[model samples]
Target: MLARDESDLKRTPLHALHLARGGKMVPFAGYEMPVQYPAGVLKEHLHTRSHAGLFDVSHMGQIALRPKSGKVSDAALALERLVPQDILGVAPGRQRYAQFTNADGGILDDLMVANFGDHLFLVVNAACKAEDEAHLRKHLSDACDIDSLADRALIALQGPKAESALAKICADAPSMKFMDAGPRRVAGFDCFVSRSGYTGEDGFEISVPAEHAEALVTQLLDNPDVLPIGLGARDSLRLEAGLCLYGHDIDTTTTPVEAALEWSVQKSRRKGGARTGGFPGAEKILDQFERGAPRRRVGLKAQGRAPVREGAALFADADTGEAIGKVTSGGFGPSLNAPVAMGYLPTALSGIGTTVFAEVRGQRLPLAVAATPFVPNTYKR
Candidate 1:
């Protein structure tokens, strides 16, 4: 999500609740969102890692695509034209991570696609929603019914205890596993609950009606294990999980391969697979798959306590070093109690344990290319 002017910012259905909880509101994705609550970012980050954290992600965009032929596979096939994922293979009540790529092989936006038997549901970034909707309509309208779910609000219940907390209010929560998604009555409200989240933990992302968003969130928070988390903690959590933030770690400038997201592009979409080279930039992406991208995204661990922030230039040496790349996302990993970051580095220098330099505050600080999930992922399979 992109930041906007405060005066022009919008509010989510739970805006009043945020303010009531002493949230520190800031402009984000054209919305006045809470960056941190009274408990603060550090506590929120650690709280989420240990227990459950509820996030008000209502600013995101929810869209539905129903096939004109009344077959879900038809819609999936249509969607494959826009992304390089094997959407047709996604089973009912299952979800997959995908990206909308431009004609030049750059990532336009990363999104979640859930198969709902009859229709497909999509959750896209708030800042790119309008353009994403337009892109979908322009390409798939002839084969599917494109509907923007403007009345829905999104919330993510993530962490180690998320399932237990949610199961109390939604009995079906226990039956769902990772990547399982479908319509479920949550907190007695009709909603779509996906057993998936950005945080690398057992969690759920629920899509509730705008009118009942506050009630649902309030009910979840009533559980002592669940705390309200803001954007600050959310970023730190995803960063530690080795996940990408749309505009920061990925954007129109980076392809899935360059971003180290090649795992998301299934073999079915690659060369010699059942469906090969139909999506945009297939030539470039597939070629990268066959060979490799020049530069690759890698995890960076700072040698000291100071956090390395985004946009910090990377150097090949500590002194008189040539600029090799730049840090895309960097921050302190509360779980690891150390600074962690991610950036692009030439493939030759992207190996784990490779030492690099990050120019920060007129100093070239040494950083090691470490294995990701700066902390181990607790995702329940």
Candidate 2:
């Protein structure tokens, strides 16, 4: 979600492999990453939509929180103190999306929390890794032991055929449903595979030792259905999927309620539940839940050829306009062959059929508030 200079960026284990494939590299989240390959973002995006696409997402932070007493509920309870989610309800081998919130109900970072039976597994934004780890250590030290898996590299295989391609190399991959994750051996290499990905498509994210990352990816690439995808396509894919990128869509200044992620906060943690209001910012969040957020993040489908970029202000019309909100992320949906964007709007203007306008190049483009996942999710559930 962040771009930077390439001079001193950290490299993932598969960075050289990306270079070999003619990747156009750039700096992102403190790492030297491939923004696109020779196939280009458009083709790469379309290819992933058709076949299988492999991506190196090792820049994400992977950590395991183990309780000293080996109590899963203790770790879940400890986690509950920091965020408003039903962590204690996580079943073994299942994962849920969670956001670390602040005292004022602002989001610190959104993450995936997996219940691994004996411990809790977390994957957070790479740019916020150090701070996230520190937050974990500072708060959960008495309840759990947090260990950052710095030696591991994460990669994802996504698309309609991702499962079949993965099954060719790993027997267990085909059996996973959405949100299922556990340790597995693929082509004799030890790894933890999850039936989840950032793309709207059904896929898997594999975490393996840094030393074995290349070998695993190499074998997967050898499959006829799999092609290497880059960050550019990855971003567009998630945007089309209606998934929120940490820094761009949801940030420390935004709360879950304002972000329209109430579905993520389980009902057990909401008001009237037996164990409610224990987490940070619970009062503010629950209050917002009842009274409704002042603003909401809504999907906009621009009805023309021009693509709207992020940060563009929204207006009622070209003349005598009032600033309503700003786009957080926008781009041409390769699959839809049209411009799509997401932004905040007042509650009164957030209905799916509502009409709005985005200011682009001194012109006003009409946009309709369509239901998101601009592309439907093909998740295997």
Candidate 3:
């Protein structure tokens, strides 16, 4: 693939801050983003595991769904038409993870939906934001007001000490629990704060106005415990946390069940539930929930010191014969001090501790089917 021109890439609200802090900018999701800072990926990854790490995720898409009927339930029900998740069950001040599945049960995109009383807030992947917005407008424009938040900037403060660092500026930060979300004055900026993050850690995702985003992030970074983190650390953190990266661990070709994301689908959307089988690909997805997907996503732990990377073919035996599966995401888990990978495997061979061989370089490396969140999550539930 040809590299995107840096001049043509979009810049986040904190682009200047990243440059000032010696961040190595790279093209990602049509945006000029910082992949790492002067601290380096390893240190950044470890720091986030131990202390608080601030991330500028402004390139992500923020959207609002306001019900024309003035009832949030109406908007939720409208959204349920697109996602298989029980959006109506997400109470006000709370959020839930969901996916936009296609007619063939493939995931269009995975997103976060938060109920904020009168309206619903959505955060979609940066790369798929345009398509996601178009989808919402095509299907839900009649029931709700689809507004794309183009002037907002999103940032994440994540880790064990994230709450303490955020609490210094936003007093209500300490009161919020996991998945709790609402509007708050964060460092004198009118921002939306959610106690949820991609990293399996206790953290907050804050959305502020574009103009004030830099100032707010600067304030948060001023805290002694908070450090500016980049995409390199963010990827490792989420991978170790067993969280899926939209285009990598999952994509339009992968379904929720096949990706090991059945938990995100509430019972209300399943067969025999109150409201069932109305979303796209309901038949195929629901069927998978009842029976099982042909293949399942599982954690892979490399037996040797060398790291197993993505696109590596997996085989049942050491001698590569027919490739049964492929690694979707893989790399060194700095927190684990070892190599961790995730991939798909046939249902019969996806059991925990089942051995599989990943073809890396010219040699086949032995890998074990391991339970995920290789590192335990620290969400303050």
Ranking by TM-score: 3, 1, 2
**lDDT score, residue 199, model 2?**
91
* Residue-level lDDT tens digits of model 2 in 158-266: 9999999999889998889999988889878889888999999999999999999999999999987899999999999999999999888999878899999999999
Model 3 C-alpha lDDT per residue in residues 86-198, reported as the tens digit of each score: 99999999999999989999999999999999999999999999999999999999999999999999999999999999999999999999999999999988999999998
lDDT (tens digit, per residue) of candidate 1 on 1-381 = 445457788899999999999999998988999999999999999999899999999999999999999999999999999999999999999999999998889999999999999999999999999999999999999999999999998999999899999999899998888999999998889999999998788899999999999999999999999999999999999999999999999999899999999989998899999999799988999999989999999999999988999999999988985899999999998888999999999998999999999999999999999998788887677
Local distance difference test values of all predictions, in order: 0.94, 0.92, 0.94
Per-candidate TM-scores read: 0.98, 0.98, 0.99
Candidate 3 stretches with Cα past 4 Å from truth are: 1-3
Model 2 has an lDDT value of 0.92
Task: Tell me how many residue pairs clash in candidate 2.
Answer: 0
- Those runs of model 1 whose alpha carbons end farther than 4 Å from true positions after fitting are 1-4
Candidate 3 local distance difference test against the native: 0.94
Model 3, TM vs. native:
0.99
